[model samples]
Target: MRRRTPRVRPAALAFATLFGLADAAAQTSYQSMGRLFTTPSERMMLERQRSDNRAAAAAPATPAGPALPPVPEAAPAPPPAPQRVGGFVRRSDGRATVWVDDEARETTLPRVAPGAPLPVDLGGRNVIIKPGQSYDPSNGTIQDPR
Candidate 1:
């Protein structure tokens, strides 16, 4: 015949019974405990968002300043003086033609009359003609030289 062996310890058996009862009680109460309410930190974040929205809605609509006047346009300036190059004296034609650096230019005047000094343009350097003297065009020199 085979010998019989002990299967459970007295202290271990009592501890197992206590643990099973505690697990059953926890399971039964799980649904009865309601969900946690909103925390303080979440409430503060919501309040801050509400304040920001209210401030944006209350902001001013128009800019603060007086209107500016319209500006007027300016007029254009006059042309510059012509540069003289040479002159001519015409005794026969009774007219002198003044030559400018630009060939297209021709300023003519009556020839120097008696008792009046002859008008002359020495070269493209200077204008030696006195007042009332005619500018000559035939030659680049003054006629009736004083």
Candidate 2:
């Protein structure tokens, strides 16, 4: 018996030829044709692109007008002086009044609760008084020093 080789059918040959032509055409289309910027048309396109980029990079100039003057800082004001006074509250109504020597001003204190000490300010000194504590307005005494 003699051995014979298998032969490719007509349809198979036509399909192979079609696939080969498609592959060749795809490769030719995808191949790079050097750098596009080397051509004169491409160089003109690049120059226009660079000019647009430069125009964008340049900042817009400010309009000419009157310049704003610098603001001046304000000077600080002086602090107020201290005050001192002396007085006692009435045991019955809890109302008290005091007079300051330095300012020659008199101020009445609000009603204090029972058993609460009375506070007064005169010149720069402060004095507190309990019930039966005598306060001297002339010498600014907290207690009887005699």
Against the true structure, candidate 2 reaches a TM-score of 0.26
lDDT tens digits by residue: candidate 1, 1-146: 99999889989999999999999989888867855645898889888999999998899756468766777777766443333334444545544554444343344555556444433343343455543343344344444424
Top candidate (lDDT): 2
Best by TM-score: 2
Q: RMSD of each candidate? A: 31.8, 23.9
Report the error of model 2 at residue 101, Å.
99
In candidate 2, where is summed lDDT lowest over 10 consecutive residues?
80-89
Backbone collisions counted per model: 9, 7
Residue by residue across 1-146, what tens digits does model 2's lDDT show? 99999999999999999999999988887785555567899889989999999987796867498876878888876544323333343434544444443333444565777657666654345567654455555565656323
Q: How much is the lDDT of residue 127 in candidate 1?
A: 52
Clashes of 1: 9
lDDT values, one for every candidate: 0.56, 0.61
